[model samples]
Target chain A: MNKEWPLWEVFIRSRQGLDHKHAGSLHAADAAMAIENARDVYTRRMEGVSIWVVESKHIHASNPDDAGALYDPANDKAYRHPTFYDLPDELKHM
Target chain B: MKNQSLIDYTLHLADNALIIGHRNSEWCGHGPILEQDIAISNIALDLIGQARNLYQYAAELKGDHATEDSLAYLRDGWDFKNLLITELPNGDWAQTILRQFFFSTYQYFLYQQLQHSKDERLAAIAAKALKEVTYHLRWSSEWVIRLGDGTDESKQRMEKAVEELYAFTGEMFLPTDYEKELATNGISVGPESLKEKWTDKVRSVFEEATLASPFKENNSAWMQSGGKEGKHTEHLGFVLAEMQFLQRAYPGAEW
Candidate 1:
């Protein structure tokens, strides 16, 4: 009934050799409880092989107001695309 | 009718799971928090799944168009052999968690032995269910410690829960006639053998939780029993009334 429990962000790795992706958030009294809560909430469907949890306060985010300055510069940089480089005929798999 | 004792044994196990699972399901949407709500419901689902497996085995033994649904929905209250502790009301969150911890601990050790049963199907079922029971034990144990060691009000409530539920713990270790017979044949474990290990685990957890062990105060205290023999608390009557209503009103009905 205590609504003041801190919020935590949950991340789950769906399988081996995969990176953890943001699943969602929940409130818990501590780290151990957060992990358990995340397990119940995010991995109930056999969705993950691993889980990671961090307090919401520990995660820093870039301000949405800076979206243009932070990401717009890369939008027109089509040269950064790997498709621009030609591959040798011998590199068939690439 | 070929192996009446075995069928009875299987139904006893199934009844325990189904009744407790039904009790836990009552908390589905009413949990104090959403995450915990899902957690208890998931545990309920696991128990019901175990019940289904057990009931299927029992039905096959009885062999006259018997099925798991019939076994679960058709039986009267007196026909059930679940432990009385499972049928008791979930008085509070603390009571429910404590009941789970005690029962899961008993099941944890019981299944460990059952995994080696002379019956192959029983052994296989025990092996699979052991994995789920392991998580239940851990989850319930952690909650017991948290609530027992938390603020004064929480600690007080945990103490009250222990007082309300501890006597029923004794019935878990008291084997019924069928259980005793099955134990002799190595088909199932005798509950008597599990008492020491269950007590040790509960005591250690209680120590860590800063709670006193009631068993230490009086090891020979009077305990409740008879559920395994089909006698149950009044609470089970209400539970069965609601659970069996649909099936009773409309026989052979299906979605």
Candidate 2:
């Protein structure tokens, strides 16, 4: 007789990072339960130092039909990638 | 004599872990949600891991080719010294969570004290097990709070769960002869001494959850015992029958 809870996208920060990467998704009754479920599901193996759970409904994704206009321009901007830079011989580790 | 008592005490701890770990595992693929399914299974694995360590140590004490598998898989109900609470059937989600909350709370305190035992290996095992039991306590207590306060149906179910399981809680503190000897040697915590703290912890959580304590009504509820002395309830027989099946059917089978 219980209704299905909301879907939450789980983001886990494995270490020091500016952003948490999407680990997976799960269903939880509320935001508090979402965080706890995210911890148990996505971070059981010392996988993350922090977790952020956002309801999937709250996320806005670009239409797949607009992918060409929204993303193709970035693909041609090869210089945006750090790999395009030539490191000095002394900075080999970089 | 000293070694025998140590082995007995060690098996007591191992049996509690093994039986409860097995009980928790019955929830696999049957949890209310997938995340909780994984969470409970992880807790089960932690308990079973603790049991493995204790069983290994016990095997070392008993030197006639006894192994962890033999101790865990070959033991009959009367040989298992797990407390009666651990062997009870996982009735419902409410019952499961409440049972876990009661036992894990006790284990958290017991392992905290055991971490300082004079026996070096037991202390080491307790130190490792304490970390896992801490999480188990938190997880189960949170569930207890949520269910007890969530909805009319949940509150009713949780109250029934608490009432049914509370009687078994007392047996966890009943001092066995081996435990008494170990207590004198600073190797085991005096079980009865822990009752006050256990009651306080349970009372505080129940209060927050808006559920009444069972202690208020039945201070003299008949308690089930004898598990520490290697006697157990009928439920344990079924648990062992299923758990010991593969090993019993195919002796010496291994991966």
Candidate 3:
């Protein structure tokens, strides 16, 4: 039997100014093929305007085994919020 | 042709699209790959949409002899006048592309000629179809080029495909008696003129794809006609069974 190619994570920007949200994942032979595969996999209905595909292996993440240690400290930093500062009239929506 | 004859002609063309579109729909979720699956289904939808319009026009032309549903659902496979190319089994991805590339090329030219039809209804439908067909033609042409030149495996399959598929392609532009009669009376365009345009378009795409221009590889007049005359392949009968099963089993049933 033939070996399967590695899987990649797919991210898509639905429109300009929007973040490249993680849409889904699919298997591909390489990065270039990944983007094309993502196009077919995720955007058949013309949902996204842009696509970015990266090998799932290339992504680094905090250790799920050490999750509490990585998260306990930042929980107390409420003072870091910018909510106290009022926006100017031109920036009212922000 | 007289108005009644013209309506028969339109129903003939419409039935071809309807049956083939129904046949293609079988591949929707079962394609070897997801992208290709969607692409084939998309083409099916396009053909079905086009058939809906043509069948409606046929009904109007007949002054209410048969509704679109009657023309589509009630008709036997023998009544469909589509070319043999569309009815050929989807042998493989390469074969599918070959059939699509050939059909879309003919469709593009045929619709272009149809856009100039004397009848306003036909002209309008052709104008709309011309735009969709342009995209279909381009997409199929691009895939043909890519697969034909991509690798040894793909190249061999594609070469085999072109040779195997060419026979069925000829029926597409063959002028039926109805097409001839309508053209003489100024209601529709003769399909003969579009043959050259189809040849030129197919030649360029084949050249770009690095495959032998059919004439370059082997000048074989591998044609099996009678499709445009409402005869069809064995595969068409099975396809009709599936397409008509729901409608046939429960007459006039709708969602």
Candidate 4:
């Protein structure tokens, strides 16, 4: 009947990934336990080479109410695409 | 420990993993937390995988149409050679953790020594299993310390777990005749000699956890035995009945 442990966000670097990706969340007593729990739950399929866990409280998220003000302007920026760049015929794979 | 003795020793190792792994699997979906439920299940799978490897090797050694499934599912409860400590019921979270601490600590040391076994298969299997057992040891040890130091109720539960499980531990060091032979032949390490190292490891962890050592000098005579000799508690019967039911009923059905 102990108080609920703190929530942690788990990130796993899959064997093919160069960076850890946010996988899921779990409750743990500490960082060490969080990492172990992450390994057991998220990497049971040989999915990851590394793991990182951060307290859920530590992550800041943008407010839903400000979503239009924060990101709507970027939606019309078609120049962000790299398709306009010219490339040699031999470089087509890129 | 050549031939039958070596086979017996291998079976002993297999049975330990199988029984304890079975016990841990009992925690599936029942853990206090969802993550730990998965955690214990993962450990259970590791142990059962180890058991499969050892049992498969044992089957090869037997070589008279013996198969891994047969060795695992066909054996009667009394035919199992796991330490009595492993067959005990999982009483509570504290008891489960403490039992795991005791067994995995011994396995950690045993596997480390076994990596150098004269038998190449045992050596290879031990080398592979040493990795998993190392994590098992760490996980269980951390929980033991956490629970022992956590709160009044937690500490009391851990203390009771230690007292209940400590007596069963002596049997791990009591070598059977075949084990003595294997130790002499360099096929396996002497279980009796591992006592001091096990004691040191257990004592250091206990000190950190602020728990008292439950060891008593004259406890061996009073400690339980006969599992290694094919005698077992009532618990093993129930465990086997459930574990072996599929094989028993299907009679060689394959998935």
Best by TM-score: 1
Give per-residue CA lDDT, model 1, range A1-94, as digits (tens). Answer: 7659999999999999999999999999999999999988898889999999999999999999999999999999998988978788888777
lDDT string, candidate 4, B15-37, tens digits: 99999999999999999899889
What would the per-residue lDDT of candidate 2 be over residues A4-86, giving only the tens digit for each residue? 88899999999985579999999998888888888888888899999998999999988999999988889888778789777
Pairs with steric clashes in candidate 2: none
- Cα deviation at B99, candidate 3, in Å, is 0.9
Question: Cα lDDT for residue B1, model 2?
Answer: 32
Q: How does the DockQ of candidate 4 come out?
A: 0.80
Q: What is the C-alpha RMSD of each candidate to the true structure, in Å?
A: 1.6, 2.5, 3.8, 2.5
CA error at residue B150 for candidate 2, angstroms:
1.3
Q: Tell me how many residue pairs clash in candidate 1.
A: 0
DockQ, cand. 2: 0.73
Which 10 consecutive residues of model 3 chain B have the lowest summed lDDT?
Answer: B213-222
Worst 10 residues of 4 chain B by lDDT: B213-222
Off by over 4 Å in 4: A15-17, A76-94, B217-221
| Colliding pairs, model 3 | none
Model number with the top lDDT: 1
Quick one: ranking by DockQ, best first? 1, 4, 2, 3
- The DockQ-derived docking category for candidate 1 is high
Q: In terms of DockQ, which candidate is stronger, 2 or 4?
A: 4
For model 1, how does the per-residue alpha-carbon lDDT over B51-123 read when each residue is reduced to its tens digit? 9999999999999999999999999989999999999999899999999999999989999999999999999
